[model samples]
Target: MTDHNTAEWWRQAAVYQIYPRSFADANGDGIGDIPGIVSRADYLAELGIDAVWLSPFYPSALADGGYDVADYRDVDPRLGTLEDFDRMVAALHARGIRVVVDIVPNHTSDQHAWFQEALAAGRGSAARDRYIFREGTGPDGSLPPSDWVSTFGGAAWERVADGQWYFHHFAVEQPDLNWSNPEVREDFLTTLRFWSDRGVDGFRIDVAHMLTKDFPDPLPSRAELDAMPQDGAHPLLDRDDVHEVYAEWRAVFNSYDPPRTAVAEAWVRTPERRAKYASAESLGQAFNFDLLEADFDAEAFRHIIADNLAQAAATGSSTTWVLSNHDVTRHATRYGLPPLNGRAEKQGAAWVRAGGPEDQLDRETGLRRARAATMLLLGLPGSTYLYQGEELGLHEVADIAADERQDPAFFRGGEYDGLGRDGCRVPLPWSASGESFGFGAGRSHLPQPAWFADAAVEVQAADPSSTLSLYRRALGLRRRLQTDEGLEWVDTGRSDVLRFRRPNGWEVITNFGTSEHEIGEEANRIVLGELRDGRLPGENTVWLALRA
Candidate 1:
């Protein structure tokens, strides 16, 4: 059993991110719930992950796929109640898997009591003060208060019957709260305690960088906002003010018996800016998305690895690495595309929109690179997060019908115009063939493709060389290599290859070239995954344990 006193167990942990609605469904409800997660505790334990990070399951309008939380203290009925949540946590704990839940503190659903009251209380009321409400500019107050645009699309401000405009970073239904208000800060603290008291291990903070807004005199236009220098202060997003909020949250976490922890989903521009969210006084870790955004190039990866490790060390924080999440396309599909060629920033929500021809996507090639990437990621010396079904080599469901697409981005910018995140959130496949591929007893909330049968857990489990087995083997072996030490580069004089030596004499090497690379006779290596013909094939990674 993991000792709660360790307090730093998250430093080198492997966390599985379970998008509740897509993970598993125990009942015939078509939606994954707490009971389903409870039943899968054994599967997770066998997968050898250290913890499970559950995406938002709180009461929500699902305007942003549960990011529009209605109640921070209660569970959504579709997912389950607080009782089911407690039971799920207990079941996971019995199997030695920690539970880390998603916390969306930046906004609340329009259906939330606070938001509802704010809408009825009219402008200048105390209820309205809890949220970012302003009078629209212009003659008739018809125009929005600012030119700021939503992260999903369209205008960020929405007008109410009271002639006031409210700010929402994502959807009109998700109103951003005023963090500057003492009541808002205190209420979040109460919410944090509610989960901590319930024995939750940690939290993955959503919109962690966008919590603080500077309210620029004339809010920047969409283009200007996107082009603003992340190094300097901005009107909204990653402002210095956000750190103050995390610092206080850290204090609350420290007050707990073992001191709960947090990882921020802060997508800042530079490694330096990302480090600020993971400093000793703030959240314990901030996901370094630079690695996820890296192109399939050795030089690009090497630079990101070195920069991220350096930044984490400087801040006394653990480096968090993740390849894919609910919001982005799976790396398998991503790697299948042409290399970004230093245009990694283009890999945003609209990646699929700018994608090449369907024939250009080499799924087989992408799967090979994904296996190699997993080895490289697992071999690193820090925390790693794996999205659900990624172990089964699940690619993004590209053909999600317009009617089935649920992401707010897809609707905010007109149907099909904005390729939403629904593709990545397809229900996972557990069986080779079933009504919903064993995702649930009924129709899945999001339809699974017929191709999912090939990647089903049942099919992959029987195949020793499948990606599921690769993840299981890698994770089972990772426990022995856990450490806070950073990685060191092993120069092989090849620009297309990346070789890094861990402190334990374990070397991780990946060849990005189109040719096979020789494994020196002097080196004794364990074939990690997807190695071709006993040699390190192009886009393959292997781990070497140098013998004395």
Candidate 2:
């Protein structure tokens, strides 16, 4: 457990992300709820994470997988109630684990009371002014207001029956809020205070870079956007004005006794731009996703690490490292598959939809590389964010039937583009023999593949060589080995291997190539991987203690 009194505890914390719906189900409803999280509090504590970052458990109509929040202050009835949320927070705190909840500030569900009122209040009404509403382009106003497109696909604007078009960066069910509206800004401040008062340790701001937009009278077409310089400010993303919103949010966060912390889910292009969200006046941390998008190559990982370190130093903030999340394919599966040829964002959706050819994936090699990659991730300086089930080496459930797909991206022409994220959101397998593999008494909302039986928590728990055991040992060792805020690169004289030394005299060496590498260090203990004939095996990571 981390010392809460320590300043910026999150800087060194190991945060675990729990996707609420698939984490665990306590009520046998097939959907994970707050009580389910409470039930797993001991498990989380045993996993040795400092905090659990819960994805949106708020009231929703299942639009955009709860990103389209209908209400910010309460839990969905299907998931749990306010009392249950309180209980969940208390339970984790009792185990010395912090609670970080997700906050979707960019947009709100159309089902929200405010949006409902906006629809009824007619065009140009005060309620309508709370969201982005514009007139159509054509004479009869048949076309949309702009040529902008949603991140999920299709036109960003949705025309209402009243002949006015409202913008949604995502699905039509999620309407973008107008940050220029004082009411919209103040209401979000209230929402922050509501959760802060309930004792949440921090927040993970959803689409943090997208709160403010700078749409011209006639928005540039998609082709023009493609031709624009990479450094140019996006019309709807990472605009300069978004920082002002975070400034206000920072004030609210600072008003609390412990001063709640936040991490921005900003997807800006450069490390410098991303660091702005982690400046002193903004959110204290921002996810460095370059690692998630990189190949398993050693040079790629080295470059990303150096860049992230420089960015963090510039902002005086810690880097947040994550390999897999609910939005992408599990690293285990990705490592097993062939190179994506620059289609990393798709996560092999097209290949998976085609039944995942055996020749395309080397499962054993993938798991080995995934383990090595995690070792590299944990050994790095700064905070580490672990997605749920990565500890058990879970793979993407790619063969989910098309008829059962629920991700809004799948329905909005994203399937053809191989953009659906459902494969990574399958429920976890706890037991090997249960009807739903211990997810719940009922069937899971997304179908679980049969291979999950081999990866069940029970089975992994009993196997010492399993990925679960590796994670436990690695996490336990990390708590002791992580003594400095930076690392010194150790030259291995080989391009295929990476070696870095922590200030405390602990060295992390990983062999990324097929050839075995010699262990040149005289260490007191081998913390993680093993050595064959005093040589580190290919695709293996070893941690060594070189000092007292």
Candidate 3:
């Protein structure tokens, strides 16, 4: 943890991330792009987000759905042009919103220029130093230095046509970059400067934890990591001397003004380590997988929050909590259903490409829960990341066929757990008008989700009771509150009910529990909006100001 005494304002801000492929397609090419996102900035500002984070627009093989970077500086032609991004950035800035972009430094596409250089150099070459290589024989004579498995499954090492193995923690096509190399560091820093100069407010550093693995050697088996212990680093993660690499990047990010830097991803595995990374001194912020990993235990959640706050105190660092993002099963599918046979088995309307629609979760129940969830997201401690369409309570889409799926995770792990991301990545619904498929007439990059026809934004805008209206109101309330200056940084009272009382005298209270419960030690003052008894209507909450 660095110094919160002088932390940047973005530290107190909330951000929204848009997966471009699914945001809205203007060209009708079945893909969402910069222009499409620019069109929605007006609506986004209505949500009162501090900034916008557009997933990578870099040119790529689309190997890992854009994580595989073939080129860093250029936008994918399919998405749009460099000018389109310039306009999008300008438009958001015009609205007083800050911005961040994804930077996958841990690795690059195998087709990346650096990787190509390494491939040609083979072993005992300068470029080869940019990646890990081991000399050994395997049972099959075609295996990794050891039996390490990639996050996507199978061996971590992939054989090149030259009979050499390159390591990839994820999909083989997405080769992991070696941070230990000075040249690699220089190149990435230059890239950072390139964008920061372009006015990007910050970055959501992808795989920040894995930026450096001190020594490249054979790793323990998955069984070993899973069996040994959860206390230390999960052997699969936590390589030695990682701090040096982060320190380097931290130094670089610090050199900029307003810092224009935000680091978020699933990197920290333990509280002590999480604190070290999120420490104001190390990296800007880290995405809390703790919240996403929580099973439906209110006590567990209470414990997680308690520990996170305590850790923040321990390191004088910042802590963040998130419900869902582009990578996971949408929150509706994960938390909306009642515990059936010990888990929420009902597929919260997950998309199944060409597999037809799912009616298990209806509009009223789903939308209400969505409203309730968004309320929690905004009211939670620390900064928030709002996934696109979540404001309207979108559900998991149909499971696209394996052949049509683009996510490498789906392709690597086979069926079942490998469900394609199409459900969560489908096009956004923007209007009820005929032929207005989300972002007007442009070629769609992917098939439109079924809700686009009637459940569009225009239809919801006219109805005060619509979820869109709920979102606007929520954002308005968020904008109106301003007591952050006086609140205790690590308050843990009202455990089951996450509570934050701002110096502005406004109390942001949420009921993450299943049943209703009354808060406040005394009679409530004028309710900001309608109230349902002392409790909100099902896991809901209200924003209030105390009256003396």
lDDT comparison, 2 vs 3, better candidate: 2
Model 2 per-residue lDDT tens digits across residues 78-187: 99999999999999999989999999999999999999999999988999988999988888988987677787779989988798999998899999999989999999
Model 3 scores worst on lDDT over the 10 consecutive residues at: 347-356
Tell me the TM-score of each prediction against the true structure: 0.95, 0.95, 0.86
Candidate 3: tens digits of C-alpha lDDT, residues 426-486: 6677875535355647535555655665667878788887667777787666665633523
Local lDDT at 90 for model 2: 94
Task: List the candidates ranked by lDDT, beginning with the highest.
Answer: 2, 1, 3
Of the pair 1 and 2, which is ahead by TM-score? 2
Q: 66-100, model 1: which lDDT tens digit per residue?
A: 98999999999989899999999999999989999
User: How many residue pairs clash (N, CA or C atoms closer than 3 angstroms) in each of the candidate models, in the order given?
Assistant: 0, 0, 36
Model 3 TM: 0.86
Candidate 2, residue 305: Cα displacement in angstroms equals: 0.6
Best by lDDT: 2
lDDT for each candidate structure: 0.84, 0.86, 0.67
